[model samples]
Target chain A: MGKILGGDNMKIVMVEPINISMMKIEEYRQQLEAEGHQLIAYSSRAENDQEMIKRVKEADILIIANQPLSAKVINASKDLKMISVAFTGFDHIAMEACRENDILVSNSSGYANQAVAELAFGLVINLMRNIKDSDGAVRVGKTRKNLIGNELFGKNFGIIGFGSIGQKTAKIAAAFGCNILVDDHKQHKLGEELGVEYLPIDKLMQE
Target chain B: MGKILGGDNMKIVMVEPINISMMKIEEYRQQLEAEGHQLIAYSSRAENDQEMIKRVKEADILIIANQPLSAKVINASKDLKMISVAFTGFDHIAMEACRENDILVSNSSGYANQAVAELAFGLVINLMRNIKDSDGAVRVGKTRKNLIGNELFGKNFGIIGFGSIGQKTAKIAAAFGCNILVDDHKQHKLGEELGVEYLPIDKLMQE
Candidate 1:
């Protein structure tokens, strides 16, 4: 490994914008530079694989956010040692190339767990209350006649996945006095602690 | 009270249908009759003041559900002693008349507390996540460009009334990890137990 003035400074290149402001990226760059690291942040996405390759060729570490990293682009980065994905899912990355090259891959998981859980409740409430239809009716100065909506209380709320998002959703559903029914491949201790009943996927669907 | 074969039986008249079926009302009437009371139930709503006055004239106890019970109707009821309202609010009933006639007035409060609280959350979730707008957009085949929404988690949820509905609302909001700020005319011990911060109505409005 070659030594820089402060330490072994890595050339970290962010191939695509991660929805952060340029000023914020500059602040991050300054902080990293102070710690003996160099950061190259792009304000825009790479239009093509060639552009992606060009941006990541000399990077020791690459940062991306749901931008597809093909094997070709991954192979082009000869010095790439690690990839830091700014999204919960890393499927957009070339796992095969990273495995062959022994490049370490990390993702920003659990970041959107609360947000996703909240959205799940939002969608559930919308359907249960017929909010869209009610909103439309009120806008036209009409009253809800037979549009009396059902309540979530004492209802059986079934969740398919038992991940962070699912667990958070269950917590909220439980708060609303729902009997939670989970259908996950593996039994989670948290689900049990939450007083959730686990059933087969088919049974859960029926429930 | 008149002495019947069963016991001292008072005339119980249900002036209007309380959203219950005729069969259910008949069942109730049979049960009341079995207890030595004569129950006269009207399946339909009284359309006019005259109809309402006529319905209650011979009653000892009246049961109503949001149907207007004017002072004129109350005055016409010579044997009226008590009123059992099937709704949370009794403003539609003549309080002055009941006071003057020495009639006992009771209401079915807390019945719709959970339903109203759940609907409060439904409306909150809908607004926070833009569910209605998103639903509309999806139906029109348009993407949410700048329609990114705020999450209710870790947000301040201020409630105006600290009644049964408001307390239930605070419970659900707390479950969603919100900081509950309540503003009511009186401070409740339950609110304190729930770790809610009480504020003046004006102050809570600002929050």
Candidate 2:
């Protein structure tokens, strides 16, 4: 299997490092090695064109964080088969080059949906109620004065995007009794399902 | 039920009008009224102390958003029993007055936990990797720049509070492969159970 995949001991190279402390990459390395696939993990600051190309040329499976992969780098990589992005958005990858090279690229999605949506609502509430700022004042032993924030109940929530993250955000916001106004380029029946008012981008932005 | 809660034929009066849209409020009002509660919703901007005190004194249950309830107002109120705060945080309420008067003060908790935590992670990732600014540049039709974000595959996440919301936040952060660091005033065994490093508040805050 190792010979077939790497042509006599080829390796899977991960760019930079994963920031998780609980899961050791060594365990993954050993498992892959046992299965006849070697794992080569390196911290590559592939900032410029030359560095990007150099890093891509030396890998089989490349896992990137937020680094942009240019067309020049994608074309230079002869052995690169898979590019697993560690984020939801894939706007950083050179899609045209990947298509030409037949390189499969996948990204982590629906992972941070709940987290992002939760935070947006939290921010809105914090801003409305002055929780953080007020809390900060109290923590510093200051007498609370003129601290007032608004309630989210029956409030207007203008959702910019209606994707998985956006929808999840809308759902949570709805639970808080917020009237959602969603705007998406792709037309769908989510508005009817979620009871959200669908608006054009222009109108939504204006709102 | 209404008469028992108050006296005879008493109505639940809201203070100033909520800043939400009229259509949304009307929908909520219909739901509340369907439950057999007399809703005397007012949108008054009481200018003087006399007007504010009068407005508050008339209500049985004061459903308030961000309006300040002074000690004098609470003391003067003969009918006020419950202060149903529309948002989380009770800093606006004169807590001493409420306690002395036997007024039941309640605030919404666990409403926006998931949303807030998710945003915190997003903010961490975006700040670490510069995703939002990069996306902003791309949206304005700029060539993709070399904006790097950190991977959460293994990182130290120091959680301040270990309440329901904080615990939920930690769980979601844990899913992202973060090493949890908790600092709670309460004597809870979340650290041993969740594999989180329980640190002192001073230490955690410094980090």
Candidate 3:
């Protein structure tokens, strides 16, 4: 009988830590390791860049987050079969090199869409109303007497890149009585659906 | 001409500082004093109870925020007229005493509705995703492996009160893909409009 690469024969390496809320990197490590695969994970940044390249060179699957997997690093992937990104962008990976080397690259796309959207809404509200400043002033034995804040209600909120995150932000802004103006590469029906006005990128920027 | 009981002729007192956004206490003091009324303000809490009473006493009008105006203090109001509260709650003040002395009490009702609503949303996002903990862990040389967090997406979020704040919270929650179940004293059409289901207090608790 011939040996297969399904289990213990394969080596998997995770280059950096990712938000566990979006993707459970540690759990994956434990599960993959338990299944008889050799798992090596750098849960934090590598102190030495050479050590990182050395680690990934022999990997069958490379799961990474913020840490860079440069073209030079990708060139050393003699046994590297796949690169899995735990974040939105694959810019850190050398895509051309991966293609030439017949390496598959996947990403945890839109995993943090809701988180990012909610945060965007939170920040706008916080800035307009000076919530952070108010908390700071109180801590410093001063009231908002010196600070006058504005409300988010009835203001124009401009959103660029009307993707999942932008769409979610528009909805929340609508609830706060904000007039939402969005700009994106594609004209989406979501704007009209959410009572948002779509504008050209240049116009949106000017507005 | 005889001096009438205009601004300059009346004694005014401010029990505490209020948000300049809500109402400028200092500005009011200056304006009232300029208009000819005598103004006394306790920008900070009084060290002595007797001193507090003295400040509240003999004033034609008192502007306060969360400060107690006990019966003893009201009794000292030899010429007390009105109590303007810069916050929603009036229970802090001796309402019965104010009524017995024919003193009118007014509060800045619903002044912080937007601020509270915005903050409520911010906190829920932060907690659900372990944002603060993640930031802290990174600063302390650790990754999210030590902390696994959940997303607000597709979560059932129950709001106990369906007032302004609760409704606002629901609006933001809806934006985050949360199913909103609200329990309130009254049924509002806004619930149906926002696609939020109204549940009984007990049912909401169980859910």
> DockQ: which candidate is best?
1
DockQ of each: 0.66, 0.05, 0.27
Best by lDDT: 1
**Rank by TM-score, descending?**
1, 3, 2
lDDT of 3 by residue, A86-124 (tens): 888788778888887788888877877766777675555
Sorted on DockQ, highest at the top, how do the candidates line up? 1, 3, 2
TM-score for candidate 2, please give it: 0.51
Lowest summed lDDT window (length 10), candidate 2 chain A: A1-10
Show the lowest summed lDDT stretch of 10 residues, model 1 chain B. B1-10
Q: What is the per-residue lDDT of model 2 for residues A143-179, given as tens digits with 9 covering 90 to 100?
A: 6566755556577789888998887777666655578
Predicted candidate 2 versus true structure: per-residue lDDT over B50-154, tens digit per residue: 887887776677788767888999898887778888776689889899888888887876667655664565456555555555656777897545664445546
Docking class of 3: acceptable
Lowest lDDT 10-residue stretch of candidate 3 chain B: B1-10
Listed per model in order, the count of residue pairs whose N, CA or C atoms clash below 3 Å is: 0, 16, 3
Put down candidate 1 lDDT per residue, B32-147, tens digits, no spaces.
88888999988788899988888889988889999878999998888888899999989999999888888889899988888888888788878877788888798899988667
